[model samples]
Target: MTDRSDAHTATTPLAGRRVLVTGGTTGIGRAIAVLLASEGAKVFVCGRDAQHLDDALARIREVGEGDGITIDLAEEENVARLFEAATGYLGGLDIAVVNAARGAEGLTDMSEADLRYTIGSNFTAYLLSAQHAAKAMGAHGENATGQGDIVLIGSMSAYVLGKESTVYAGIKYGIQGFAIALRRELGKKGVRVSLVEPGLTGSDMVEGTSEEQAERIDKEEMLRAEDIAVGVHYLLTQPRRAVVQQVTISPRMQDEE
Candidate 1:
């Protein structure tokens, strides 16, 4: 066998790159994973649910090289383990997509446990995952076949807000800031960092949206998971000398105010 690592060297921008996508079982994460694989990336993905993991892997395999494991990124060790396992499967990762996140609505009505869970899932997981991804990317160096990239999936909610989006927005603002700082610190390593803040995207996160917002989605007024994936791919394909550090994607019909 020629091996999966050498598979994508032929044509497309993402050809032959090793990629890791968190929350790959559903939503924007799944969309990103499938797209990357189709572009010839050796992709490994993770989710908390076993069935979702299998399903996502099968879907990715339908179009490209893909593997999966069940993981809860809330735990720091699990984040590290994910990187380790992915490195083995993909022959070291060139891209890390931190798209796994949970939202907490109504900080006023939510319990302490709920607060912790959201923070862990949203903020802490992102930080730890980026830390581990950065380490893996740094290990490869600029000259390595797999160049480095960390793509953080943030929410436009960092600037826009809903009635109960306090917790969710808070977490996004923290991680978004973190990604920018990490990019600065890693400038010497040639690892690219990008932040994508999407608005009113359709996914499991939509389940938490207000009925008014859901109505818009039902009417095809919001961005689909795949739409966001396309944007991420566009960012990923940019020349090595360029990077789209941050961008916000939104549905045309939806009002941001």
Candidate 2:
């Protein structure tokens, strides 16, 4: 007879899982990294800011084991080194959160350099990191057993199509498409590709004081970065036989602008 303990597990556990979170030094990425680490995952993170990286690592170490580096994921060389460092630190990877991005400017206001950097950071980096992470997880290898999760942190901007977000919307629409197709492509191999679209959230990207942000959260006008982190954790803890393709989290009172 099968033991009752084995027959009825409430949820898949995250303990001892290996994870990488790019752009994890601040904001939503930082929250995700810290939350996962607190759950006992061995986390490796990267960010463009050295100070933020150090602070994030300190927070992670307080709860669980982790390491990190400072590097912009927009460059191919940096992305390569990031994975190498992650693998070396964690030994192997079971999950990756692709969340790094640059805020977009109006098309007419964007300079050539701004355009290039925004595209590279917001869109191209996601593709490149996904490529590396999939390969590392053996998604394409002969032994391609179902074995990994890739969560792309997209935005509700893809659907809202706000007036000031021409470039940002386009990139997010591209990510929405990429995530769905990638999931289908990798489904048979056991790698889950999911897109998480967050609504207005209080973070560095949003301009506000701590008190203002707190008020907005209280009013349900915005979400906390940690709220999205909880949503991500839900995605990662699903049963192996199941998959959550997408999650769109928005404040209860948020409306299209």
Candidate 3:
């Protein structure tokens, strides 16, 4: 639709919109769902874990209006099913948040399975989801303003180098390229594609870390999942005439390596 608000309430712009978020059962996706619903959106979320999906749905219901589905993005057929189900649930997809991601172990520990799983779950999923979202949003013709949005959640690791993050970085980097190319191709169709890159957010993905390491890394100073959700709302709320190509958010206190 249109984003008319300032920084104080960027999410207010998403009111009355229909949005679908992948991997929304926890972490950043869950935060995006909650914030979008609070802003008056009919949000739909998907995740592979049924229990997690149910929990996320309950939490969203408690806070606002939304639904959740269980589907593994790694499976192409499942990805298709998710879009179909989400379209029906949301009454038509107006916005898509591609947040599904999986981590790969260190480069030394990497195997064919790890590489395939990483790419399949992260990069490939976004490509497929964007393909589906573009079709669904384009099918709606144009809103009164003639536009829709597809936001891909990328990572700072996409461009950075970390000893153990090589494979994961590759996936995130691939997503960046995917979003940029997709945006160019879809611009004529009035479906804007954007990339949101958030750095170091607190989530279950890092739950395995020790408290000492967590402190050393200063998780407290890292970007919060809700913060990225705010960014997603901002990008989607922009007027049809405006497009935010990409946004990178990190904790002010975190140093770039």
Q: Which candidate is the best by lDDT?
A: 2
Each candidate's lDDT (Cα)? 0.84, 0.91, 0.83
Where does candidate 3 clash, by residue pair? 3-237
**Each candidate's TM vs. the true structure?**
0.88, 0.94, 0.87
Model 2: how far is 85 from its true place, Å? 0.6
Worst 10 residues of 1 by lDDT: 138-147
lDDT (C-alpha) at residue 101 in model 1: 87
Off by over 4 Å in 2: 1-10, 141-143
| Candidate 2 lDDT over residue span 1-257, tens digit each | 75687666467789999999999999999999999999999999999999999999999999998999999877768888999999999998899999999788788889988888899999999998998888888886656765899999999999998677999999999999999999988889889998999999998888799899999999999999999999999989988777889999999999776
lDDT of 1 by residue, 1-257 (tens): 56776554332379899999999899899999999999988899999999888899889999999998998888758888888899999887789999888867789989998899888888888888887887787633444332488899999999887778888988888878997897776655778889999988877667556566567777767877888999999888877777789979988877877
Q: In model 2, which residue pairs have backbone atoms overlapping below 3 Å?
A: 146-190
- For candidate 3, the 10 contiguous residues with the lowest summed lDDT are 138-147
Number of clashing residue pairs, candidate 2 = 1
> Could you tell which candidate, 2 or 3, scores higher by TM-score?
2
TM-score of 1: 0.88
Residue 201 in candidate 2 has what lDDT? 96
**lDDT digits (tens) for residues 55-127 of candidate 3:** 9999888877898788888986988899889989889888999998876787779788878887899877888
lDDT of 1 at 44: 93
The candidate that wins on TM-score is 2
Task: Quote model 2's TM-score.
Answer: 0.94
